[model samples]
Target: MTEEPVPVTRAVDFGTAKLLPDVDRARAWLLTVDDAPQSYVDLDDPEHLEFEYTRRIAHVLESAFDTPVHAVHLGGGALTLPRRLALTRPGSRQWVVEADRGLAALVAEHLPLSDPDITVHTTDARAWLAAAPDASADVIVADVFHGSRVPAHLTSVEFLREAVRVLRPGGVYVANIADGAPFAFLGSQLGTVRAGFGQSADLCLLAEPGVLRGRRFGNAVLAAARRPLPLDALARSCAGDAFPARVVTGTALAALTRAPVHDATATASPVPPDGAFTVG
Candidate 1:
């Protein structure tokens, strides 16, 4: 007789989410919150990034350095990217600052980061970033969000400055932002990152062509670095990706950075309208 699979469910502080095993892929799990898919993890294959935005971030990380480097992740959803870093760049030290302690604990209980190099802290990302020492991290990744909306504090110029301050010279800072047509929030964020990193910093935005065109609500990956970004290589990687994405930089990025800068007074990212992310 075949054995029945164990049911997986957890009650996080925000809401109830599930860590369902992928039937077709061994050691793979999908995390969902409020009916929205948040993260996917394949323990057997850490390099397999199932989300387009996540894939874009991974591409930036791969293009940033040839070997493992210290990284700080400002969100810990399923600890997906950190696990990927641990596997892809063995011995890389990583720290994750997640606001939802319950969610963090639940994820750890089910999908533990067996690697000793990755540590998860239950704290606000902004606070952690502010407390971090200068020039301490080689890479800083900001993927923090409450459900689908990123807190305003995390997007403000004040927050971006802390992120920039924590990075080593030539270190890269990457963030995942979601916005709809008009892209006011994304534009402002791009502007904020550029402003924080200064004139010499290289900035790049990556996302599906549709998202870039402001046709619908979607996630965009924004990367900024003190040194020149590897746009050529990143463009090639995105071009060949399963979910073909594009990179916007140079004059094109300048055009998009027209939005006003967001400061501490900014509100949380505008929430998507009902049905914007709903699947039929």
Candidate 2:
């Protein structure tokens, strides 16, 4: 038998980045920054989403529209979701903003993206969003993270406004937020997103039942749009996942309360408990 490929490790801008191969899936790689799991991509199968949060994001988009879309990704970790979108929605145009140039280059060298429609930029996500043309993207995905926590500036009302500004009418804004019981950060983020969308939008939170019920620390996906969301279809799609998730809306959603975060007061999300997102 041939020797297994060793993990590729590099010192990226933010931290040490590693691409560990999946023994079961030859072309699959798991990316980690400072020991925190960041992204997993199966080169041979772009449709395969190893992370639950990614699947939830896909559920929101798939349930919302069946046609090609103009998508902006705030975080580009291995370009996993972008690759999936390219396959699922052919002819789709995508822009990915990743802050770490070294990490982006590492991904490019190891896991090159073949789609001519997708472009990758090395810059701050919030800054890129501010400069993006009005109504340019049909979907904006906010999955940026600094190590295991979300950066403060990207969690503010101003950033949310920029995200909304970059989206086309009725477009969706989806973010992968992590929080546990007494979800102060999560609550504040939901409030900030709602405030950004104003009174005309439909907002929903998706997460595993345990996570919602305060049983554990995990990722929660926030999806908001100006138009009515396909809640019924989204609910069905989420419930059918390998790790079934629940969608929160209406009064249950309203019960989660926190002040909208402004740039001055914004803080990075709370640090995860040990091994909360670590992958061996």
Candidate 3:
């Protein structure tokens, strides 16, 4: 099968990326930044997730709550997850905090969100979370990144605390972190989340088997909540997914959380080496 050409391309503040349509699917579009896959959108089927990490996050959101919820997204790359949320749970109020105005505008003009409940704001994710009222949202998602690396401020304990503070009782906080083998960055982020949520909070880590085993560089979905997460349901969801993944909680999560906690002085997430994700 031939790959679909990107009909539209632009140079944004950070780098250059393009929206490439799926040759087989008329409504599907894949966004890539500097040739690295960033986000995928299926306008016709928001429930159909093309990326493994995104599928994990969607599963968490589905298992986290049964009713429509108020969600705040820290990053807005293509707004794929947000669009899925709006479709799966109608009437849900969603807010997106994105720092790239040009990119946001590009997505708005090209793949405009049909959900009136979804609002986009161009600002720093940390600043927005800090200014948000306490216990104001049922879920908070952190997926902010600069190029391939997550910004230092977003990975700090202070940022996690702010995210937890904005979540209502029994609310969930989920973040998508990318790292390489040994997963030192992932471990530190887990520690930071654990510290912010405390021992009583339910924490779970989901990723591909290879990624979890430190054999590859990939994205991991870290989820935490003030109350117990529906692990049974989450596990079932992961199993049923098209791209099968694994969930680690309880003892395994504790082991991973042994890394040192990161504060405000922490630097950005470690960058993967050159060609880590490049196409052959």
Identify the leading candidate in terms of TM-score.
2
lDDT of 3 by residue, 49-114 (tens): 888888889889988888899999998999998888887888899999999887898899888787
Query: What's the candidate order when arranged by decreasing lDDT?
Result: 2, 3, 1
Model 2 CA lDDT for position 157: 93
For residue 167, model 2's alpha carbon misses the true position, in angstroms, by 1.0
TM-scores of all candidate predictions against the true structure = 0.94, 0.98, 0.94
The true-versus-predicted C-alpha distance at residue 141 of model 2, in Å, is 0.2
The alpha-carbon RMSD values of the candidates against the true structure, listed in the order shown, are 1.7, 0.9, 2.4
Q: Give the TM-score of candidate 1.
A: 0.94
Q: lDDT value for candidate 3?
A: 0.85
Once superposed on the true structure, which residue ranges of model 1 sit more than 4 Å away at CA? 1-7, 260-262, 275-280
lDDT of 1 by residue, 1-280 (tens): 8654454777787776777778888788888766566788888887888888898999999887889899999988998899888878888999989898888987888787778888888999999988899999999999987877888888888888899899999899999988987888888898888778887888999999998887878899999998889998899999999889989988988988854455645778888778765422
Writing each residue's lDDT as its tens digit, candidate 2 over 34-138 gives: 999999999999999999999999999888989999999999999999999998888999999999999999999999888999999999999898888999999
Model 3: per-residue Cα lDDT at residue 44: 80
